[model samples]
Target: MSSPPVSAPPALEVTGLSHSFGRRKALDDVGFTIPQGRFTVLLGQNGAGKTTLFNLVTRLYSNRSGSIEIMGVDLRARPTVALAKLGVVFQLRTVDLDLSVKQNLLYHAGLHGLSRVQAQARIQAELDRLSLAERANDKVRQLSGGQVRRVEIARALLHKPRLLLLDEPTVGLDIGSRQTIVDHVRQLCATDGLGVLWATHLIDEVRADDAVILLHQGRVLAAGDGATLCAKAEVKDLGQAFTKLTEARAA
Candidate 1:
């Protein structure tokens, strides 16, 4: 008889994750797995501890109470190896406005230990991928808000991390720009086999087929495919389902 195939570990996993500041709990035993090659939306409102979760995963805040793993590597035990498989676009913009787009990406590439020739090649490829090739030499201050966001995405991907974490990536853009970013990231998950954890409060961004984790305050209220959550809530759409879930939690 042939041996059974081994399953791949999840792209990202958090188990029994908890955090607190003083007496206020920020996260309470949160746990979820982001499967490889899929888009998972961390759906929540403001103050929902989404950023806290991101902080723990990215090691911005020390994970005092729970475990985080990347590609089956424990984050605390193997920081460098675990972080090597992760990329992040934080909620706040981090690119330098004074530098050209290419310069910004090159600086990021260097931080990841890429030499000049390697950085240049990867930068060009990502610029082309994001349709920002024409803007490569332009100062970041000259780019529009959406273009700046794209630049951040390009910078994050310089190392080709397997898992991408985007925190409220579309918060400040116009609807057209928001949709463009959303569609592009979804395409990455589909075509490039990149696992994504997209944190957002915008209900419209939740699609029926996408994995959805509904978080309120510091806890996960529900988690499943969007279609399943809506069906369970007896609602017509994700928006209504979200409303129902949050309201019940509040009550």
Candidate 2:
């Protein structure tokens, strides 16, 4: 007899998720699973509810009618517990401009209730990984945009989260800065086995093999490996694939 198929638990899972305002549905029964250690990008145009989904995951906007599980913990049942295993970098720059990089990190560590010694060690390690050790004491405002962005990332990782969520993190950054941030995030996800959900408008930032969910008009129109979807359309890159997909949806 053939063996039964094995199943792997997802690092992040959403089921029957739906949200709406008066006369408007922002998310209509959207569902997807992100396997552990994958770089998953959520793609969409404005008003497609990409950020709304991000907010749902982060619990900024409560999910009135769905389930979200992170690392097997139900977000609604145990929000704090589920959130503890996740790190987030929002679309806006979140670093304290007046605070030194080290100080900013220290504050974040404290927010998670880390002791001084523990925070110090964690901060040092993250700075080293991002190659920001040499300028750790500089105020964030004094640093370049790229450096400030890196500091925000370092702060997010101070808790040693297993899942990282970045919402349009590279928005407004120069080409070089954008590439640098993308490279660092890609490397971190691959090397540390960290699950990442990066929401962005730029198709070039996501790799073809990475998982992708295309949100259109408050609905998920497609979800799969980027390369596979692109191949289905004979597209050379994600940009072309996105154009094809969205155009078809509109038609």
Task: Write model 2 residue lDDT over 1-251, tens digit each, in one string.
Answer: 22212364566899989999888999999999877678899999888998889899999999998799998899999999999988999888888899899999999999888899999999999999989999999988999888888998999999988788999988888999999899999888778778889898888887878899988888888889888778765787878889898889899
Residues forming the 10-long window of minimal summed lDDT in candidate 1 = 1-10
Q: Which residues of candidate 1, in runs, are more than 4 Å off?
A: 1-6
* lDDT of candidate 2 at residue 229, scale 0 to 100: 75
Q: How close is candidate 2 to the true structure, as a TM-score?
A: 0.93
Q: What would you estimate as the lDDT of candidate 1?
A: 0.92
Among all candidates shown, the one with the greatest lDDT: 1
Write candidate 1's Cα lDDT for 1-251 as tens digits.
22212487888999999999999999999999998888999999999999999999999888998899999999999999999899999999999999999999999998898999999999999999999999999999999999999999988889999899999999989999999899999988887678899999999998889999989999999999998889878998899999999999999
What TM-score would every model get versus the actual structure? 0.96, 0.93
Q: For residue 51, what is the lDDT in candidate 1?
A: 98
**Model 2 CA deviation exceeding 4 Å by range:** 1-8, 234-236
- What lDDT does candidate 2 reach at residue 198? 89
CA shift of 172, model 2, Å = 1.1
